[model samples]
Target: MNKVAIITGGGSGIGQATALRLAEEKVNIVVVDVNEKGGNETVELVKKLGVDSIFVKADVSKQEEVKNYVKKAVEKFKKVDYFFNNAGISGSGKFYLDTSLEEIDQIVGINLMGALYGARYVAECMLKSGGGSIVNTASSAGVIGQDSVVTYSATKHGIIGLTKSLVAEYAKDGLRVNAIAPGPTETPMVREFYAANPEMKENATGGIPQKRLGTPEEVAELVTFLLTSKAQYINGEVVRIDGGFTNTK
Candidate 1:
């Protein structure tokens, strides 16, 4: 079906890749991100793929901004068929106890609440138009315990919780809710993490059976799969794209 999709964080990383891939499939794209330059550039790229696209700049965590994003998207596209709550921020990268309350709020506010706000506004639209898919970006950190950036991991685990709960509540309405748990991916965010800690950089890739970092395109492929009929039976599940990082000793 030719559908309209709103992808948060479409300015870059896995979100940008997903927007491009979906547009290639003839899906109308609404690219939302705080980065004006990157978001508009993504819209340009999607338009080049012969699909309609728009860029809405919003802080995904704020209720008003997220509501405005959905409002504008519906005003433009009339309906939203897919919502990818992919915008996130890394907190003060520290041990959980050492992390301050402000940093904790930052992680919870952006990573967890951002996804929640997107789901809230977009789900209302999907319920009115027809049911649709919602994909939240979790991480390998969500699947397993992590020492560094512990608060970020906690928020990701909360994302998994939210995904499953929403799936159970909305499945009757034809809404499929799921999450993608990416491993060490080569996004700008991860690149910065790797750069800051050389030993961590080695450990993440070497610990994975694949012995390398995954790509944003790979995560995008998984997001597309879950959003499409191929994963119609898949709901309330977190698909791990960690290249055996969770399994390897």
Candidate 2:
């Protein structure tokens, strides 16, 4: 059977990489993003890989938009077999006390609430279809206390909780939920964040055992495995692909 996947944040970085990786396996894709250009670009790329694909432009922080993306995926593909609840944003890297309410709201709105909305709506579709898998994007900050990312860390930690708790409620019903906690990944989001905080880039690299940031391709590989039957028994796990960044901490 041809698998179907809905990837939020699919316009770039890890979400884009995972969409392409899954497309290679002939999986139909629904690329969801607020950026129309990037989302359509991903759809074209997936088509070149010879798989059915479509783009749904959406701002995931809004519950209605999140539901619409899921609806569009089902309308296009008939069923959603995998969901990458990966849309998120990092704050201005200010100290928690120094951060503004607007920044806090934006971070929580996209990172935490967005993931929650995606999982709720997507899981409903999966349950109706009899089964499915979901992969959420967490961060090393989610697992361990990190400096200068208090709000981002809070949201990710919530992601880990969301993953395990969802499995606790739905695993027996053929639903699988897992999260990935990546560290200092080399993506546009991270690049922009690091560029704004030049000292952070050097500090992060110095702390990482690998001495370099991870690539989206690497995270995509891990996502592909967890979303497929190869990881049937790996439900509710938060696998960290942080190059030992969290290991030493």
Candidate 3:
């Protein structure tokens, strides 16, 4: 049987790239996102690769919607071999004291809680199906400190914690849980930030040791490996994909 994967945020960025990459490997993809147009587009791309694909519209913050995503994936594919809990938002990118509670709540709800929801639901399904792997989309902000993005950093840190906890909870059941922390990635969220403050982009890129932004495909490659047998021993870890940005000055 072909392996099956359910990817949240499969509408764009790392999630979208991962969907196509996995499909090319003969894995069935369930692309879940709140954006119907982008989600459908991703499914179409996956289908073009000659693999089965379905688009699931879900707001990861809503338990009912999140549950529905898992239900559909199970009903249609019978089992889940992999899960990419990649849905997230950049929050308001504000300072700690200056940031409002509303922005903090929004960031926590989507970035942190959204991932937990997917992890809990997908891990259970994987247990029933024998075993599987799960990758959470965290940020380099999770590993290191960032003065400007207080709430965003906090939420990503929470994701890292979730990844480790779930790995412990499910490892004995043949389930693997891990997280990828990417630094200065080239995604829609990054593009929007650069467009709004062009100078900030230059400063941010210059700070990185690579002196450039990472691509979604580059990050997706690492995540794809984590979900494969080659990485069966890997779990409860946050792999950094930041091109030395976090390690270097």
- RMSD after Cα superposition, model 1: 1.3
Please, what are the lDDT tens digits per residue for candidate 2 over residues 178-219?
999999999999999999999999999999998999999999
Model 3 agreement with the true structure over 74-183: per-residue lDDT tens digits: 99998899999999988555568987988888888888889888888888888986889999988988998887788889889999999898877778988899899999
- The reply for model 3, stretches above 4 Å from the true place, is none
Error of 2 at 47 (Å): 0.6
The list of candidate 2 runs beyond 4 A from truth reads none
CA lDDT of each prediction against the hidden true structure: 0.89, 0.95, 0.89
Better of 1 and 2 by lDDT: 2
TM-score, predicted candidate 1 vs. hidden true structure: 0.96
Which is the winner by TM-score between candidate 1 and candidate 3?
3
- Candidate 3: worst 10 consecutive residues by lDDT? 90-99
Best by lDDT: 2
Backbone N/Cα/C clashes per model: 0, 0, 0
- Residue 83 error for model 1, in Å? 0.9
Encode model 1's per-residue lDDT on 73-160: one tens digit a residue: 9999889988888998766456678879988887788898988888888998899866999999998889889778788898899999
